[model samples]
Target: MTFLRDLLGIPGASSDPAALAAAARDRSGADPDGLPLAVVRAEDIDGVRETLRLAHAHHVPVVPRGAGTGLAGGALAGTGAVVLDVSAMDRIVEIDPVDELAVVEPGVLTATLDAAAAEHGLRYAPDPASAAISTIGGNIATNAGGMRCVKYGVTREAVLGLDVVLADGTLVSTGRRTVKGVSGLDLTALFVGSEGTLGVIVGASLRLRALPERTLTAAAGYDDVASAARACGDLARARRDPAMLELLDGLTLDVIDRAQGTDHGRRSRALVIAQADGPAADAEIAAIAEVLGKEASWVEQGVDAASSDALLAARRLALPSIERFGKALIEDICVPRSRLADAFAAVEEIAAEHRVAIYSFAHAGDGNLHPIIGYSGEARPAGVQRAADAIFRLALDLGGTVTGEHGVGLLKRDWLAREVGPDVLGLHASVKAALDPRGILNPGKAL
Candidate 1:
C-alpha cells in the first residue's frame, strides 16, 4: 500500500499516519482495529476518478467519506484501505429557481445549500440536526431524515439526480433534472442510501421547494410519556400537516434546563413541540393545538414565531445537552405511530430494570424515538448494550425497523438480518455483489 498513493499521483492525497487514523472512525464513536493506508482529499471529479481508478487497479479497498458526521460507522476504515475524502469539493454549481433545483458538489454542507437557496426564496427541506456540519454527500449516503421529515421528506426525496463514480472508476449519472421521470430503475435512489458500498457520489442535483411565507408553532406538556405519544397520534390523525413535531421527556428537559440555565422546569413528564408552515399556518396550528389540548396537562397555543424558533433551537440541542450530564449512547428506533406509546413504556421499563439513566426525545410525529442512555456507572458498555438491546427489540416487536434514517452501518449490522429476514438480506447481498464485485467500495458497510 506504500506505493499505492505514489502510483495514483492524486493531488492532495496524504499518507500521514495521524490522518489515516483520523479517517478510520466517524461520529459512530467506535474505533476500528486498523486504519487506511492513505487519505485522499479529492478536489474535483478528476481527482476522484483517478484515485478510484488506481485503487481499483491495485485491488485496494476504497472508503469514500464526507464530513464524517455519520452516527453509524459507515466510513470507518477497518482494513488496509484508501480513504477518499471529498470535503474539499464544496461547490454550488447552480440554483435554478424556475426549475426548483440546486446542483451541488458532494462536500457542500446541507445548511450551506439551504442558505444559498434561501436567497432565491427556495429551501432544501431535509434539515438534519447536523445540517450545520454534515455534508450533502453524507446525508445522501445515509438517506438521512430529520425534524422536517414528518412534513417534507428525507434526503432521498430531495435528491433528483446523482453523479456517481463506480468501483472501477466508471462515472455514471442517474435520474434527471425534471421532477417526474420514470425512465428506468431508480438508480439515483438506490445510491442515495447505499452508504458508499455501491458507488461514490461526486455530485448531486437536488429538488428544492419555495420557502414558506409564514410559520406557526405550538407546545404542550404531558403528565406521562403515553399521553405525549397519544397527542402525537392525535396530530397524525388531524388533517393539518406541521413542518415538525418533536418530543422531549422530563429527564431530557431537565438536562437541557441544567445545560442552558433556563426556567423550563415543570412537572410535566414530557414536552411536545409542533409547528406548521405556509400561508395556512394559523389554521394548521389551530388544529394541532386542538389535538394536543385533549391530552396535554398544559398547552401553549400558537407560540410567537420567535418563540417557535427558540423552541426548535432548544429541541435541536437535546443530544448535546444530555451529553453534558453523563456518558450518552443515543439509540435511534422508529416504531409504528400507534405503537409509539408502547415503545416509550418499554424503554422506561428497560431503564428501570437495568438501572441506567435513560433520557429520550423523538420526532414523535413520525414515531422515531432517540432513547439516550446517560451512564457513568460500573461496566457501562455492558449496561448500555443490554439497555439498547431491550429497546431495539421492543421497537422490532412493534413492527418497526432497526434504523429509520441512519444506515445499517457497523453499529446496527447485527440486527439487520433479523429485521429484513434471510431472503431480503440475500437480495441486498446480490445487489452489492452486482455493483461492487471487488468489495472495495466502503467494505463492511451498509450491505
Candidate 2:
C-alpha cells in the first residue's frame, strides 16, 4: 500500500471501502471474488504506466475500468486486484477532418468525440447504445457495435490505431494513422477486442466519416417474428443498405408499449425498424416500406428527425424496460442472418421449456439477438442459466456465435472454447501467454 502511494500519491489512490466496492464491480452487477486492494484514478497516460508498473512489481492483478457501463463484467476486479480507473484521462487530443481521424485519450466518451466531430460535419459511426456514457476505450476493448453496424461497421473497423500500456508498463503504439495498412500483424486489432486481458488502452486514433446528407426511417409490424425476420432477408436480397436495421419481439414491444402507453403491445408479434441515410434516403425508405407491406400486417413511415430519434430511443429502452419484470440477464447471441427466425423459434422453445420469461430483440440486419432472461430473485434462478445456455447452444447450432458485440468477459469464458474449438482455444492461450505472461492484467476475464 505504501509503495502504491509512492507512485499514485495519496490523493490519486484510495482504498476506502466505498471506492473499493465501486471499483471492484461493474455494470454487470457481478459479485466479484472480493474487494480490490484499491482504485487508482489515473489522470494521464503516465499515471497509467506508473500504476501498471506498481501492479506488475507487486504481482497484483489490474483491471482497467472506463465509465463502468459494460454489461459483460469485463471490468470486474478479481480479489486483491487494483482497479485503474482511466476516466480521468479524458481528452480529445486531435481531430483532423482532412485525414478523417480523431485521436483521443482512453477516457473520452464515445458521444463526446462524436459531438466534437459533428462540429466539423464529420461523425464517428459505431454509435453503441451506451455511447452517451460509455468511454471509447471500453468500446474498443469490446469491439462494440450498434444499429449503425449494419452499414458503417463495428468498433474494430472504425479504430485505426491504439496506444497500449502492456503488462510491464511499456507504452506501445500499433497500427497506422492512415486508412490503409498491412505492414504487420495488426496488434491494434488484437488489442481492440481483447477486453482488457492483455493491456490497458491509453489512447486511440479512430476513423470518421462525413455526415449523411439526408436520413429516412420506416417501421413494420408483423403477425409473427418469423415474418419480420423474413423481411430482413427480403430487404438484403433486394440489395438494400440501411444504416440501422432492428427487430423487436412482441414481449419487448409490450414492455415499450406499457412504458409509453402505446398500442404496439396489444397486437404486434414483432416490429422491424429500418433507417436509410444519404442522398437517396427517401427513395430507399419508400422501397423499404413497400417491402414491409408485402409481409407486415402494420406498416408505417419511421421518417423525420424526431421520429427517427424516437424509434431508436424505444429500441434503446428495451433492456431496462424488461428489467422491470425481475432480475434480467441480457444474452447477446448472433446467428446467421437467414436463420434469425429459426433462432427466435428455438429461443421461444427454450423459454417455454424453462418456464422463464425471455424477451427477444436485435440488430436484424446483423442477426445479433438480445434474448433477455428475467426472473425474480437475488440469487440467479436455475431456469435463467438453462435459458442462457440454450440461447448460446442454439446460436452455435445455427452456425452463429455466442456473442456478437459483448465480449466473452467473465460470463461467457466457458462458451469461448465451445465456439472456437480446441485448437483455436489453444491458440488463444498461446497469445495470452505471449502478451501477458505475468497474468497481471484483468485476471479471470476474457479467456
lDDT of 1 by residue, 1-447 (tens): 445746447887887888888888998777887877889999899899888888887788888999999887888886678899999999999999999999999999999999999999999999888999999999999999999999898899999999999998899999999999999899998999999999999999999999998888888888887899888988877755878999888888888888988645465778899999998898888888899989888887555777777766668778888887767776789998888888888888999999888898899888889888887744457878899888878888999988888778888887887899899999999998898788789887777
The 10-residue segment of model 2 with minimum total lDDT is 2-11
Candidate 2: where is the Cα deviation over 4 Å?
Answer: 1-11
Model 1's alpha-carbon lDDT is 0.87
Q: Each model's TM-score, in the order given?
A: 0.97, 0.97
Q: Which ten contiguous residues of candidate 1 have the minimum total lDDT?
A: 1-10
Root-mean-square deviation of Cα positions for candidate 1 versus the true structure, in angstroms: 1.6
